[model samples]
Target chain A: MSRWGRRPQLSFPDVGSIEGPLLEVVDLHTSFRTGRGLVRAVDGVSFNLARGHTLGVVGESGSGKTVLSRSIMGLVPGTNVERSGTVRLSGHDITAMSLDELREVWGMQIALVFQDPMTALNPVVRIGRQITESLRLRAGLDRKAAYETSVALLKSVGIPAPEQRLRNYPHELSGGMRQRVMIAIALACGPKLLLADEPTTGLDVTVQAQILDLLAAQQRERHMGMILVTHDLGVVANRTDDIVVMYAGRVVEQAPTAELFARTRMPYTEALLRSIPRLAEASHTRLRAIPGRPPDLATELKGCRFAPRCPYAQDHCRKEEPPLRAAGQGHLFRCWYPVGSAEGDAALAYNVAARVPAALAFTGIPVRDAALVAPNAVGSA
Target chain B: MLRFIATRLVQLVVICFLISVFAFLLVHLLPGDPTLAILGPNDTPAARAVLLHQLGLNKGLVSQYGTWIMNIFHGNLGASFLTKQTVTNALGVAVPIDLELVVVSQVLALLVAIPMALIAALRPNRLFDRIATTSTFAMLSLPTFVAGPLLVLVFAVTLKWVPATGFDRLSQGLGQNLKSVILPSVALAIGSVTVYYRLLRADLIATLQEDFVTMARSKGLSTRYILMRHVMRPSSFSLLAGAGISIGTLFTGAFVVEVLFQLPGIGYQLVQAIYSRDYLVVQGMALVAAVAFVVVNFGVDFLLTILDPRVRRA
Candidate 1:
């Protein structure tokens, strides 16, 4: 309405006063109808992020972590894609909103930082336009205001020479700088929720830490809810308030970040943590890899999705599935023999005595008890 | 950028030289003689031999080419063996019609095809997409020979909207000139519209799947805005290249349309010269058309660099 009258002012209403979590996702399932069959990428995943809190969704490729974030934004749209379930932003049901209605919500109520900054920003457009689009359109800022706010947004994201950077295209900037511009664009409208899907996936280790720290700092400064999706457990270990571990399209375990790391229950989660190279480890320490590939989600899974590779998996785990059940305060896991518990310890010992290959390989007991078992204990392993 | 343009210009000069050589050889290698086409069957051998000597045709092929090319550098294209008219003078009368037809048809084709492509790409495989694609195929299948007469029959014979077959001078009112141009341009443009639409729509659909498009969508940009601002430029690479190729090879399409509608164009001149075996005129027309082809493609290449910054650096 400044100078040239148009549509009325439009932006995410400040819903900071609402009583519940900033965002809630209930039993979201996303599947693609491919030539082979229905590939369920995200299945029955549920989580919540309160105001100013960061929720990390950690999983490997094809585990539906990226799909989960897109689903929350209602970004998955196609004839071949079938998405169902509920996603609420500040108590408004996003899943039920029409695409047109969701358009109003996107970038205003919630914005997403993409996985790869290299391909996220438009190659032909200047960084100024990319960062200030939401400001001018949704926030109804004037041309001058949008430009000024964009410079500030860039500066807030730790970019130097903001004015010069604003005029540059995506290809002009380095990988880390492009990612910073992406973060600036995401935070431009002061969205109530930010979905960052592996924001540092293609960056080097040092740049990865810088981007992660930058996102965390912005999340704190704006007090916006965030869902950080990544495969590396170490990336989210210190940044997130809560963590959700997805395996084969389902949320296998989720808990408050510190609590979950302190008492890791799910074997998949434990294996993911072990894979991260630790500083205290001696040079050339062999990283522990979870022995098998993630199961193909197109097939019907009748038991625990992690059972085939679990070191302590028993008959119960092979035949029956476990729900996401709580063990302690705010800690949830899905396992027949939860990691570090008495039942899990007993199961591990029994497997070692019975000479289970996975159990032997996991515990490093093969070298110690090599004479106790036959030489060829593992086929694939 | 300067170096790139300079390189392309060099390539164009080499291409023009090759095309001239090719045109000259094409006429010279023919079984018939040019003087026979000029002096007629009743002319005596002495008259034809004198004409051949005067024209320098009795010289070796290399010397003949060298003399012809040297004259071209001196701004002479020789003369038609039949009409005794300079090729440049003939081309001056004909080049305008062909250039206007090509320009109008290209403009018309893009004007219609771009919007259609943009719309069809939005919901590909749906009802609107299906209709547009089906119509594109139908238009593509209809050759200029068929489409030209069909347009003439419908627009001229029945509706009397335009002349059935004829050329009009631009000195006549602009409206009168356009009236005659309508049928031939439409006939020439319809085929290219289909080709360009299909190419552009496919590229747009592919670009729409790119991650940056999704990022643009998540920014709350309208579908149309995203399609135009975020999607269209990158998607138009193939379309621009196709346009370049079409403009370069335009004589083939124009030939059919001009003959069908009786328009004065380079293609028509080439056809008539070939029928009479007027070798100098035929070679001159071919050389002119080839130069146009090379220049058009060169401009399009420059445009491609302008549209895609990555291309300039590369």
Candidate 2:
């Protein structure tokens, strides 16, 4: 191995020594003006990520999770795309930075791992060249130094016989191995932040665990802040320090991971949790699928965008938008009637009694009892 | 790679045999008797029979084919019916002119088309792309007959850049030969450039949309690096495939170009031979053309495999 962690001739932003959180995104909006209309892909998404902390942005398809990560890095491309926000990296405003300035930030200060490894790595280029490109060009390393650093990067990402692998093209490697190569390329510059947008997607179950574990190990070793963007809540449940649940281009709920899970207020968040398959359940148990598609982002939307699919959606939820309100310190959610809350249980009971399809679907759980337990826990604490 | 080459060689042989059979059949397929074409309307019953006997046409069809094939294998292309000149000698004069024209035109086409497509692809539908796209389409509609004369009128007649019409051998002087061939090469090359540019531009636009290109951009690679390193080769697949069939223009003599420019390439000879019913010359030229077409396509396939490793499985 060619000396891991030795970034000779390369500059790195000192982690944890910064005055503020590693990244601060305030009222970030990324929208595309398509033929249909203006599509607000990421609408007013805001969050702060501390150095060495892992924040999970959880959502289903088209939930704007991916766009949020890209917006923060200033990586969103397209002439028609418009981004309005304040994204500060290490106290410097990233969103206001020009493209030439952003180029220096990308891969050196903030790098991204794309979703599909099959298509992420350039198929024709050798694994070595793809990894060493940033080193030679951006880091000002010579050919031999870049070559050695590339092999070391491949080794750090856990590729075996990285020297031999350096000569192999992407097609020669398996999907898992290609992702590792992608990780190596992203990590080649040793950026302070790693935004992995669905990193383990499209891999086997066994390989998924390994890839996620490798990401965690690398994140901890480098003390880099990471934004794990995935649709699967279970993927981030134990791995992340904080979680943001997005719906229709907006974050509906967010909290520290354990606190969010224990006192999950949003019905959408509760529904997401129930949707994950549990091993304790009997084989062939029917999966709890979230009902209805997400609202069309092109059309102007008011109120809670998740109202139509939410089990405890009330009339007020249909009429007016719910502002982000805190359930506890650092725990924010948007809902008129939250899950495990007194109003949430009443709305659920009323809906089930009135034969509302969404609420009746989840009547298998004792909604009232859960709400009762939550209030007592809140009072005691 | 060796296996790919081996398979292509097998294919080339099979293709050549098919061409040979077609060439042999052409005399019978088109209403023609080599001796009748040669003797004119003079009283020639005995002479015709003597010529037929010498030609081995007195034998049955299968035997005639076998004899013809064997004669060709021995490097004997019989004398032209019209001129009484050996078919091999006529081809010896014509082939070099055609080879030069085809090679120069195709090289010129690729040299211009590659960069044109690349720049156009960078900003698709923008001013540069639209202008290039429109100009190529306009050129694509102009056949070689029209384009060849138009070029001569502009560059040769009006501008007095070079001789309007002539054929000079390279041994005379490379400069005179190039000057003689310039108009025809541009005329022939315009069509190829249009085709290659359109194909490569479309493919490059599509390739730029691929996920890997975005990944490259995310790596802080410059636009040029992402385009050249990640985009160009994958985008060239269709252009390479188009070049395979277009190579036919190389040997099919580009009749309009040769005749218009007064270059005695194989195409001009083939047309002249057809008019005079010089069946032996036609047969020889046809066989050479078919072989050239197949060989060029095999080379295209070989180049494609080198560009894209995914094709190595074939």
| Candidate achieving the largest lDDT | 1
Off by over 4 Å in 2: A1-16, A364-381
Candidate 2 at A237: error in angstroms?
0.7
TM-score of every model versus the real structure: 0.93, 0.94
Off by over 4 Å in 1: A1-12, A365-381, B60-63
lDDT by residue for model 1 (A106-217), tens: 8888999998998888888788988887788778898999999999989999999999998888898999999999999988888888999999998988999899989988
Model 1 reaches what TM-score against the true structure? 0.93
Q: Any idea how many clashes model 1 has?
A: 0
Clash pairs (backbone) in predicted model 2? none
Q: What is the interface RMSD of each candidate, in Å?
A: 2.9, 5.4
DockQ of each: 0.50, 0.50
For model 2 chain A, where is the 10-residue window of minimal lDDT? Answer: A372-381
